[model samples]
Target: MDHNNMITKFDESKYLISMAPVEKVLEAGYYLNLNDQSNVLDLCCGYGEMLKLWGEAYGINGKGVDICDEFIKKGNERLEQSNLNHKIDLVCQDVKEFKTDEQYDVACLIGEVIFGDVSGTIQALDPFLKEGGKIVIGEPYYKQKDVPQALIEFEGDLLTLEGLYDTFKRSGYYVSYMAGCTDNEWERYISWSARRDLEWLRSHPKDKGFDNKEKWIDTWYKMYFNYRRPYEGWALFILEKI
Candidate 1:
């Protein structure tokens, strides 16, 4: 199967697609101060939950860009059924290549889609934000300075919390509101992810990459408990374009 197909399966059971504090997701959405007229651009929006939340709670109009057509189609259908189709649109496309001439009141990059780095992401997304608009980014961070070589590929070489501030300033963004995932939350999310992988493998034991995937399951848990758990974190940060 292609990479996107695997992604669809791996994340099929997930709704919002972030390990960040789930309740805080809505709080960060509220910080956008959206209304019926507000426009949001959600990059890598999974299952369209963010837009759905904003639309239902704050009555915002928005567009979501994701590479998964299955996800986008389901989201669009639900929106149409709820009489929300007029306000929200979900398009299937690689977010990095997504384009639009229109500017939005808020631009969001949530979960697993930072194209290069946070700074590069800000530059790529800056052109789409209105002058006073806010950008909400939710992703992982390296919690410790001593890095594990094995985790780097999956870790994204993330910034420490302090370094993130420097990065925000470097990208000409002003930090507004932020929420960090608790250790309990991280443990819960990681364990849940492992469970999902295990469940997939159990039913598809004969799948082509079973051996490789099985190895990953063992490695992931081993690395998490030993290296990642104490040294990594997820957070949602709202930034203002400076």
Candidate 2:
């Protein structure tokens, strides 16, 4: 049973996979003071909702890159429907291989640090931005400095909030504005995610290939409820290149 595929199937219905709520997403864009002249690049942009929101709110133009074909296809459809196809372009490609000669006012790496080391990824993206351009990173952090080693390993060496700040500073960026997801927001996200997975299981009960989905949900529920909710935190950090 492919557990990763099961989880992806579970999250197919969600627009934002991160703990950051819609309000927070909009607030992040607002803090950037984006305008019609702003050009942004979103790396690992799942479904391109953030770009769409910014396009509508601030009339910003951007490009989004993601490896998922389904997400890119759906994002383009949404952009066309909203008449924003000209404002934002969604491309299906690995973010690591995505390159552009154009520089952007903002570079976003939202909720995707788990794919690689946060510091390395941020440094790699610096060249794509114009001078004084801001970078937005949405990542998970340990609630306390003394978390279990196992949990830290599970998170790919997740840092504390202070450590995260220092990492950005060392990477030649300064933290300007930060927003942490509230406990209620985390609960809401997890609950909705579980519900969506359960709905999928119910609708596909006869599919033998997905028989493990139920177990996957149960395991994920326990991990979130018993582990992550108690010891982990998620935040959106707005960083200015120093």
**Most accurate candidate by TM-score:** 2
lDDT of 2 by residue, 1-242 (tens): 99996774344336776677777888988999899999999998988988987898899999999999988999899889889998899999988888889999999988776347779868877888898899988888888888776666656578888899888888888998889999877876788778878888888988884668888787777777777988999999899965
Q: Using lDDT, give the best candidate's number.
A: 2
Task: Score candidate 1 by lDDT.
Answer: 0.80
Candidate 1 structure quality by residue, lDDT tens digits, 1-242: 49996674344325556766445766877777778999999888866877877787789999999998977988888788778898899999998789889999999887564578888778777889988988888767887877887778767577888898899998888888999878766776777778878998999989998898899988888888887887787788899965
Quote model 2's TM-score.
0.87
How high is the CA lDDT of each candidate model?
Answer: 0.80, 0.84
- Candidate 1 differs from the real structure by a C-alpha RMSD in angstroms, to one decimal, of 6.7
Q: After superposition, how far is residue 66 of candidate 2 from its true place, in Å?
A: 0.6
Superposed model 1: Cα runs more than 4 Å off:
1-14, 153-156
